[model samples]
Target chain A: MATSTPTPDTPAGPTPTEARHRRIGELFWSSDPNELRPWEERFTLSATLLLLLLLLGSPATVPTTLLAVTGLVARDLLHRTWFWMAVAATFPLGLLRMSWLAWDNHHFLLLYWIVAIAITRLAAEPDEQLRRSARLLLGLTFLFATLWKLGTPDFRSGEFFAYLTVSDPRIANVLVALGLQDGTVVPTLAAELRQLEPGADAALPIAPGVWRVAELLAWATIAVEGAIAALYLAPLTSRWRWLRDAALVAFVLVTYPVAPVSGFGWLLVSMGLMATSLTGRRRTTLYLGAFLAIAVFTERNAVRNAIEQVLSLLPGVG
Target chain B: MGAIGRFTGLVAPLALVLVAVLQVWGVTQHDLSQWKGGGFGMFSTVDANANRVLDVRLVTEEGAFPLTPAELVGVAPQGTGRFVSGTLTLPTDDRLDRIAELAERSAWYLDEQGAATSDPSSASPQLEVQAVEVTVYRPVPDRADQRLRFEPIAHRRLESPA
Candidate 1:
């Protein structure tokens, strides 16, 4: 075997502490070769504990703070980035678990808001890849949502009559118990075709030409969905962004009753889109808008309450 | 093979883990000869006293109906995860009993593909379902589901009941 060469500073060899520090520094913390030092055990332990909390699906404020401190320490010593990764990994889970208890998923607001910030910072990078990824994700979310909703016949048929009929049991119980969920005495939207007695149709009170408007809305939704699908591959230009934002808003405005909160998210997205359009700065403003929208909706539905409802329903789920 | 190959090897486990999580998302049980679906995932640990075991499957129909929820009350502090939720479709409970006995005797890793493999005590077992807490998961939201409530056990002994 070839003889090992010693550094000029230490002709014999590195001391135990030096060797250990060097090994640890090289293995875990930083990428720099000349520098070598063990990470503070407190930081390491905090990170480990935070990781454990994530696995256990019981992230708390204490663990969150510990992780933030760890990230700062890591930045100071390692010069490598892990702040976003730590947040991304642990935060979403914490919110999801909290949502499981609360019967709402508002906890996601905290994570999504931070995601917006990260997206803004990342938007500045010269590589065009993140921009592409963001574009794809936006399209994917809408497409999946569309496909999922479409796959449900009741959803497409606007037969939320079952849900609405049962929303208030005292009003609906007698009719539903009779197996007549449709509150209407007649299928006026069907057989008679919109012309009923002088009074407003309780199920649908529309303007004189509203049937045409309703039909147009259906086609408009389909076209907007198609546009969103195309926008994913379309160049990341200002015009496409405007169209996308407008289409999303239109979708929310149109699909008012199905999922009101999603529309709320689009409304906030619209404001940010407008701001981003005006300044063309694109990073901080976009994130702020997206997060603000998500936060607004989610907080309305607390995490713990949502989780409780979801979990409680799970035992006899079928 | 150098750093790249080593990097791929490291990533393999992570990829497997991610796929497993996705599988959890896609988890549905089929009633071998029976039929069903429509429940979310839940977990329960063995009280460790009864040494009881549960075998279950999560499944639903192709036309999975959207959940109609009621005013959600709240989430529970602790629930099932250590146990697999499944059912048996048999003329008798003998096979189920045998399977549960075998399952309790030694853990087996069963994937969605239905492939099972045995590992020694020292081996890192992937599927170690220990408890079977049979529960009713309410799928609709219009009504609040009733649960079998019990007082919290401070320190329940792990020994088997006579």
Candidate 2:
């Protein structure tokens, strides 16, 4: 009895396929088959442009900026055919600026977008794929980083952070709080340091509580990184998935205040929020605000000033 | 997405993961330096039984000018690229070629760092660097403080025009 009647087996609402198609249709932009929201496109372009500009302009020697600019123009302002050109060029351009690329641990985050852009050109439904790749990259990065840190005895002993706190200018402000300066002698390592010629090497004594601080920090780093890894690996149906992401956002806010890896935090924030569909709009917006806020506060010059201000408040250290 | 397109999307992440895995494997074998590409071996050498530090300087008729290895490669100071060390000496094919290459690079880094006044118009005496010297220092390994001694395990010298 084919009477133009719906089957009893039919669901009351739209089928899964219909719902997915409707969603994709809503996000469709341009004549291309790829499905990325207009906002996602704009955000990706802005992030790439800003990241390249900051990298190239600040250092003064990165010639890759010109390549990146060409790629950006070709991809965004030109035909869809040129999108592949932009994507193809980013890798070599990145290689040409290998010095900057290898400068920091977090620089690998930039490659996430580079690969995502390339995937967008190849896929019909690009947003999900792009976001999936990003999430996977972030997870992989954290997992490997966690493993690397775990493998290092120095890191486990907190000595690595101690060395960084003592030597690296980026986190040197912590010294002021220790009631010492960059080159003060640590009592424990003082004798060996004294054996060397006076000016040949600068050795500093760890502040009384620096080791404990470093130890806690080391453990905290491992913990947070592991949690982030779990976030990406968690099943889509897991009830606790959102908690892990919130923890990551909080970790970024708290840790970046001290270490202040500006670009690193910024990239993480952007990538962390890319799973908007899975994470939901409100949480994504929250992370975006957190990212922008952290980015603004951690501007290189601003970070230096903030460090200087904190140091000046210390007694006799100013 | 077509099956081929879907397959390509999968390839991107898999490729990244593969590279990362290969990098990790290479690092465990100590065959890869982990400097050029995204590798997870950063700080892996912190616990090395022995650590080597390279100190390079350009010696001139006037005085010695301190410079970093990165400067030798025409890059601004990036600290050390890796923990690995190699002996560079005269008559060694690759080492000599490297020295010659660096000599051809502009030494304006000295002027940029304000180590010397190289103004052509100024009447002040110019710092004329005559040769480059590289010294490698290794930790005693069993030392209590991990102090690096002044004695160098390897040294290289290359004469330059200026």
Candidate 3:
């Protein structure tokens, strides 16, 4: 085993404080290539596409168009320096002009902004250090999300997801197909909403089955988030790296469809994929392909809706 | 790596940590909501006590009409991101304010888009819309879809010029 002991070049080992910082750094920010695998160039490509789609989806504007084209060219040529510079520049541009209403644009912009900075650092630092930073970022995201959800009373009781399933049309459609919910129009709400009248307030009931599913989904979300947190933060999981990587992939698969924020999902998967070992060309290709499929699946609404429509047509589904 | 490169490697990780810390603080301040994308606390919590939906409608000089989300997006593309995302939850006071703002913004947009003068030669000339109102709805706990209750929560007039 390579020893932790210091050589004569440094007579004294790291001080307690320095050792703590180094240990924390190793756990969270070390980007050890040996610990995991080489991330494919495609991760950068996927990140670029996410940033591009965000610009495209924003209300048609000159700045958005310019930024999108710049990002596209940078990614196409696989120019990290140019890509990072463009991303760095877009942060303020996006903040100043992009509507605060479409806050996802801001979120995506912020996410890529961090990644671009980390990538630039990676060029100078050891790859492992950058990898560790990426892992730290991903880990903190999951950890904070889990904590926030846990702190919410509704999420604890599954009421949040329950309400979403009943109120959100997309989620309701899925629930209806699964026989967990019945899509009956609320006559009172409808009657109160006469086109030219002062609209009235209304309440709708949720089926017990739907509630049960909501509870399951709620717990599942917490579980997956908690698991992902552990995967990235804990060193113990490295011994059983396959399990950790599998959980990451599974988390992406199970959660992305329900939430369907493709850009964010791709960013997470790209960062998460680096945690797994890519020992062979074939394995890496398959891994990259699977993630790409997930990216496409989550991003494209028509594809998901078409699949849902076909599934809803099955016998016993209304 | 040169001196500049080495300096960047040290700075980058620290910057990321700072960003994460600030995001946590923002959440505590409620300055930001939902960590749905890859940043912080999105869809992590809901204000369950405030369980009411705000259905927005536009009030014109001619009459009041419902403003669907799609219409809002079409008219005020800039303000529709969170509005579209917020469809999954109960409408809050902040959200109502946003809707009112969008309605006011879109009122001018509608005029510019010639929505009112689609058939300008009609007997009753279409008048420009003036305000927006939100109809609030609450889910009847353990009740069916038909039993959901709703009422007008708030209304605001557009900032039309004299």
Candidate 4:
């Protein structure tokens, strides 16, 4: 019996190869290619109208800075790496007013964003340097985060004990009564903090048997965070990639929900995390999109306030 | 010494100046001179509300108002950018020391408490305990340094009680 050669493993139905081939078009890995389509031309129109309004109404700084950033981001989207880097580096110099920062360690600490931008600018080429700098950033952030929390008693415990006496008794009860809510309390660090400050409010009221659970979870975080720091340095170890990615997502969940929108530091962190997906191994677009949406909704007022203040600084604008 | 040595000498000061300028340009800049007790004070500015208020840069402790001796007399003070008229009184002798001591205090306090102790209706220079009185035009702008011109209004001193 003669056996016929089977067709290349096909789907259940006859698929149109030509249509499929044609549909597999050039990928816009970074920008939304949909932005170019004529159907959604309103963004372009609105942007143009806003540009005109900004030019006519606001002072030089407001309209000029907005125009510059918009132009630079647009230009860089095409192929202007050097121009992008230069503009990004010079942005804070032009846009930041000394009055905006709170006078303290925070004022200087916030300069890290500029430094990160400079590092990125200096090393931007063929995506390798960008990845390397991103790695460096990851390493620095994770290493410091772990080291700062691991040795200290406060890290595992979530500082709820110190915060127990607040007007909201539930949290205090969690800290004082439930022996650090099983989910809330990391076992090891809380135990350590309670040990250090025995009479202090850090002690969770519960059976001694339950305390080990907190300790176990705390050690896990330590191991995981340490692993992340190492994995960031180890570039070849892709196995722990999930851990690192999950930790970053977890970080967003924990930080953004709690960090105040009034603070620029946290916003910078969120922006950076989103920006990193550009060169990062972890594909994190949804989290970033959510952040952008939040900014457009919840924190829109603050953004509007900043834009208005900048506009008001102009000579003729009311 | 030699040609290279001459070149080195010529380049060092220039290099120092360049570094100083770069240092200034590199960081987030505050033009305010943070040097304690060194910066000059400015008197006040006209707000959008058209009210006159002090604009003391604690960093720079100079009155923004006209500071020149010529402007200290009964002349109209000009160019401080207060957008309002200010009466600047020049103190002499014991009063001069008093003015300096008062100015050494915080500018905000000094602003709420302005300089001239005596009103225009007060006695002339000889008996008048208060310093000289002259009009102030504008407070100083951030643009540049300025000094006011003062002219003597009266040569007579205040009369003593009979």
Best of the candidates, TM-score: 2
| Model 2: per-residue Cα lDDT at residue A296 | 61
Q: Distance from true position, residue B98, model 4, in Å?
A: 21
Q: How do the residues A105-187 of candidate 1 rate in per-residue lDDT, one tens digit apiece?
A: 11322233334323333333311322333344445444543443344333333322333333334425445455555544334
Worst lDDT 10-window in candidate 1 chain B:
B67-76
lDDT of 2 by residue, A6-42 (tens): 5798546557785564455334212231344554543
DockQ of each: 0.02, 0.22, 0.26, 0.02
How does candidate 3 score on lDDT?
0.54
For candidate 3, the per-residue lDDT at A98 reads: 41
Alpha carbon lDDT of each predicted model: 0.34, 0.53, 0.54, 0.33
TM-score result, candidate 1: 0.36
- Give the poorly placed runs of model 4, Cα more than 4 Å off: A1-64, A72-78, A94-96, A99-124, A151-161, A164-228, A261-284, A289-318, B1-162
Instruction: Point out where model 2 deviates above 4 Å.
Output: A1-81, A84-91, A97-107, A169-172, A178-202, A236-238, A276-281, A300-318, B25-36, B41-52, B56-97, B100-162
Ten contiguous residues minimizing lDDT sum, candidate 4 chain B = B35-44
Ranking by TM-score: 2, 3, 4, 1
What value does the lDDT take at residue A273 in candidate 2? Answer: 61
Q: In model 3, which regions exceed 4 Å deviation? A: A1-83, A90-96, A113-123, A185-201, A236-238, A299-318, B1-32, B35-39, B45-162
Arrange candidates by lDDT, descending: 3, 2, 1, 4
Q: Alpha-carbon error at A68 in model 4, in Å? A: 6.0
* Tens-digit lDDT track of model 4 for A23-126: 33112121332234421122222222222322332222543556544653463232344543543455445324322211222222223322333333333232
Per-model TM-score, in order, reads 0.36, 0.60, 0.59, 0.37
